[model samples]
Target: MTAQHGHTADRATTAPPVTTAAAARDYARSVVRQRWDSASRTAREEDVVDLLLVVSELVTNAIRHGDGLAAFEVALAEDGVRLTVHDNSDAVPDVAYGRGELPSGGHGQGYGWPLIIRLAREVVIEPRPGGGKSISVLVPLHARP
Candidate 1:
């Protein structure tokens, strides 16, 4: 990502796309590190973990239900980190609950979205203008600070 207008923005890492679940989480982690690594150097470690975990969950979901692998953008705005993942899936997510065990492959199972709603400042999904889906998740810098 080039330094534009003195601000670091989320850049599209590549074209084509990543199709594997493992590759998706790895890509998400890379974006988190590139964006949060800077100011996080002075912030608490827990905050960093929270952001990375959230990113992993969102990215994994996109890869699984959507078409092929997608892309994630992590931007360090003045207020907090803005994480957006774009996928080719048309499925919109909803809340579901059960008593079974968590899925071994997915990021979180057994109704883990509420955990995200509790941890993240904001979680939203909207239909992309063209043909896909986009999920935007905002995580605060620190819960205490």
Candidate 2:
């Protein structure tokens, strides 16, 4: 999917569309780096690590479980980093959007959602206009001393 822009002004700093999870992580790291470099208070290294993990989980889920990734965007917000991942499926995992519960089964395949829930805030899942859905979340960045 094409990148969705809320305002034309943001287009200049907006990251290009990424298809793979690795690309998404790289783009997200660059954003964090840019923000840290420019801001007086940089995000803690641990917080940045958490942000990368969340980015990986979101993009990987979209590509693996949500048909395929439609689009991906990472923006530096005042309080934290905002991530939006659009996929070609409308399905939303109940464990993620519902009670924020972890999967009960013993299978080793259900950690991503819980990990995301623990690391991110204001998690939202909404259906896109044409098709598929968009998952958005804010991974708060803590300032380092």
Candidate 3:
């Protein structure tokens, strides 16, 4: 899957398969953090934290709930970051938690979608041309003070 952010040309990279959601989340976090940090010196710490949070939640959801992760991408736009995670399931996520709730998980509770919507400038879920689905979120990269 590709994340279109209208900045530098989108480059696709494959993350090696990992067993657990935690592993997937960690790998994705590190990859994006490194890339984004290198790509934009002006990106704020808060913005990178938000970017990582969104990355963790989305990739974790794909690993835990969707039919496993298919691919992941982080796109750096002129003004923001775009994150996309692809999985084998076609299910569209529902926002369960209120906007104010913290996104950390609980027993049989969903916090990712709501937190994503609350944090991201925009969120989109679209069906893959072949099969499955992709969830993408765009986050503004605010300049550090």
Candidate 4:
């Protein structure tokens, strides 16, 4: 990260391509963890935990539901961490807002949607021109003034 006019600029990172759903989660978590660990300052313990969880959920969803994890980006902003996952599938995800497990028993993977929605301060889903979608989530690191 570089300093811009005295304030620290957001640090962004992209993980290497992962082949499987489990690999996606593992790789994303490691990238996020390593980046922050090497930074000048450390994030709060709770924030770090939340970040890991968010990363796992998003990457897992991308690999499981979409064509695959096309790309993953992590940005450390002034206020929080932003994670974006892109997949090659055009199908939109069903955003579950309320509490309850997925209908497909423990084997199902959709349970992450509700948790992602609840943890993220903001969520945005965008469609690619060719065919695919990207989901972005911002997880706050500090309380707003």
Candidate 5:
């Protein structure tokens, strides 16, 4: 699903819930000023939109593949925004660049990470400190058109 990232004219605000992926991402659209504001502070509409989508996809993957015990968190820093999805599953996600063509599939399921790579500045899927895996994406604050 394509999402529209809207930046409000008001100052920064901490979104409630921050519980589920959908909730957290939906709140991101409303965060305008950001937590750390400086001369270099900035936020892009496209970047936020893509970031939310990535978070949603990763959360879905975790909930679907991982055990019931799972939690996700989002942080907005000066350099960029971070999204962490923690799940009980230790298996890391496989990156698919999709340089070639897809031979079609049942139910027409494909094309998620590939879009993510194209959207986000950096995407990293690594294991957490103790257990499970965390998918972190860094969306640059100073993105250009």
Candidate 6:
């Protein structure tokens, strides 16, 4: 959410408010790269890709499904990156809150939630204080060999 550990107060760490999925992805990539570049080891390419996918899916869902993107935050952790996406809807996806099963029937939909569940850890969906929901996840990043 807000800057922590006295890190530099910049968009790279907190990100300016974004509306499109592409903008969110760009912001997330910058955050990941900035954090990993300054760390002891580099993040694996595949892991970064996974993180980007998750970022896109979440932001896209918020804008497309949820009313609209309310707030977006990305923070770096010791072993992974933390994402908190807020939307202007209170409805939480059944797949995300109920069972972590991928939708069976092919409908061109319901794939993003499953992909998010598969790639992210500590996934949480909670209703916001006002009238929306916040989805948070930790996407783990491994060091390159």
The candidate that achieves the highest TM-score relative to the unseen native structure: 6
- TM-score, cand. 2 vs. native: 0.83
- Quote the positional error of residue 109 for candidate 5 in Å: 6.7
Per-residue lDDT of 62-82 in model 2, one digit per residue for the tens?
989999998888766666788
On residues 1-145, what C-alpha lDDT tens digit does candidate 1 reach at each position? 4222245344434422655545555664565455444542433557666766776666667767666335666655544577778888877765422232445665664345555565576567777777778777777663234
Which ranges in model 4 have alpha carbons more than 4 Å from their true place? Answer: 2-11, 20-41, 96-109, 143-145
How many clashing pairs per prediction, in order?
Answer: 1, 1, 0, 0, 0, 0
After the best TM-score superposition of candidate 1, give how far the Cα of residue 134 lies from its true spot, in angstroms: 0.4
- Scanning candidate 6 in windows of ten residues, the lowest lDDT window is 3-12
Superior candidate under lDDT, 2 versus 4: 2
Q: Residues 1-145, candidate 3, lDDT per residue (tens digit)?
A: 2232344634544566665556655665565456544533556777777777787888878888888888877666656677778988888765622353554556435667766877886677889988889887787776555
Model 4 earns a TM-score of: 0.72
Q: Which candidate has the highest lDDT of all?
A: 6
Worst 10 residues of 1 by lDDT: 94-103
Tell me the spans in candidate 5 whose CA falls farther than 4 Å from its real position. Answer: 1-19, 30-42, 96-109, 143-145
For candidate 1, list the clashing residue pairs, or say none: 18-69
Q: Regarding lDDT, does 5 or 6 come out ahead? A: 6
List TM-scores for all candidates, in order. Answer: 0.63, 0.83, 0.71, 0.72, 0.62, 0.85
Residue 103's lDDT in candidate 2: 65
lDDT of 1: 0.58
Tell me model 4's lDDT, rounded to 2 decimals.
Answer: 0.68
Per-candidate local distance difference test: 0.58, 0.78, 0.68, 0.68, 0.56, 0.80
- List clashing residue pairs in candidate 3: none
Model 5 per-residue lDDT tens digits across residues 37-67: 3344445666666777876766667677665
lDDT at 101, model 4: 45
